[model samples]
Target: MDLCLKLGLLLVIYTAVNASDISVYIPQIAQKITTNVTDRSFVLVQPNCIFTQYPTTNVWVVVALNKSFSTISDSALSTPIPYSSYRNGLYNYYHTLLVSAGKYPCLPSDSTSNKVIQIGSETCKGNQFCNGVLSNNQTYRAKFILLNSSGIFDTTKWSNEIILQQGKSFQGNTGLPSGRSGGMIVLTSILSVLMAFLLLSVIAALIFGGRDLCWKRTMLNQKHSDRNMDFMPRSTYRSRYDNMYLVS
Candidate 1:
């Protein structure tokens, strides 16, 4: 019994060690568990440029990632200057704008003029960029992201992280084998009842020896008769014999 209890405790410990541990996460934005990023889109538009209205001309689109505006050093902005009759510097002459809206003011362009612009060779945070430069009355897709590690843009990289809450665990219940009942609980209950019955039986056996079926010393004496033995005293038998002779 002691060995069986030790074995049961060891089995329980082994089961606990082998159990599955899970981690879960909740995002501020709507996201699913173990998901991949896909179908991401963003538009660049002049805030003041409404359907019927227009603003001062000469604006460009600039995209960036993981680079804060404040961290940018002044020496980094050493790109070739393009002379424009309308305006040279845009959005306070900031080359990299974090917002999707391009350097505002969608100005009209001629057919011969290149509607789409490109800063051919410029590096932002060591990443070479090739973005669409849209003119007035036109929209260009900025699908190509300047990833530092990889040459092309990938949602798999720029997508949000899956934050996980750790240490959640569970126990497994599987298909049971045949002819095996609940051993521990059943055996415990049976032991309790059997112990009670065994104690009562022991007490009765101590009080009543073997059984009533065996003959005792007093019972054997009652079964015998004293008439089967010699009944007279010796002296009295002799005197009776002598009187009988004298009379003859």
Candidate 2:
């Protein structure tokens, strides 16, 4: 049982590493863990964040379903994807986006724009792009390809994983595979109950402690009043003693 558990943990770690590590494409890795993906109508880049491979001609971003750049099979990579014989092949493609110096320059570096990429199921406008469908609560990734009239000459490693959010359909940003179910609801309820107990304990302590202190102070004040009364003379017996002294 222990060996099985260890192997399970190791497998999870390996998949996570493969999913997020796009070192070559992104250079500096951001420390964010939230899902930064979309299934928007269009995927266009701003002037500063434009995807470019200068001195090369144009840039292509090939997207795949549940795949990293390194994991893509060599047979698929070696085969050109039909339209541009020079373009690199993608075995199981979902979407493609093209950026160029004419429309957008890839020169400027913008980390903020790095996380934004257009994704949808509809076909793109030109031969340079192919459309892919995105379902709710699915994870996807993309890689850059430097293309010219000949197709693709160079490419970058895969980008970080994107967990696409679909309106009310978005599950969460757990980054784990979909269709997982268990005792999550029960666990959350248990945690909430524990928190409530802690808060109540604090309140009860404050009220009870203050009540005891007030009772002690009230008793002390009453005792002092009673002692003062006890020491005072109730009546005087001076009349008889004075008369006897005068006669003597």
For all candidates in order, the CA lDDT equals 0.32, 0.52
Indicate the residue-level lDDT of 123 in model 1: 23
**Which residue ranges in model 2 land beyond 4 Å of their true spot?**
1-23, 27-56, 67-69, 73-75, 78-91, 106-117, 121-128, 149-151, 166-248
lDDT of 2 by residue, 1-37 (tens): 9999999999888755533332244422233423434
Q: Taking the candidates one at a time, how many backbone clashes does each contain? A: 1, 5
Q: Please list all clashing residue pairs in model 2, or write none if there are none.
A: 43-118, 86-151, 86-152, 87-151, 94-132
For all the candidates, what are their Cα RMSDs to the real structure? 33.3, 20.6
| Candidate 1 structure quality by residue, lDDT tens digits, 100-164 | 22333345643212222232123233322322122222111211121222222211112122222
C-alpha RMSD in Å of predicted model 2 compared with the true structure = 20.6
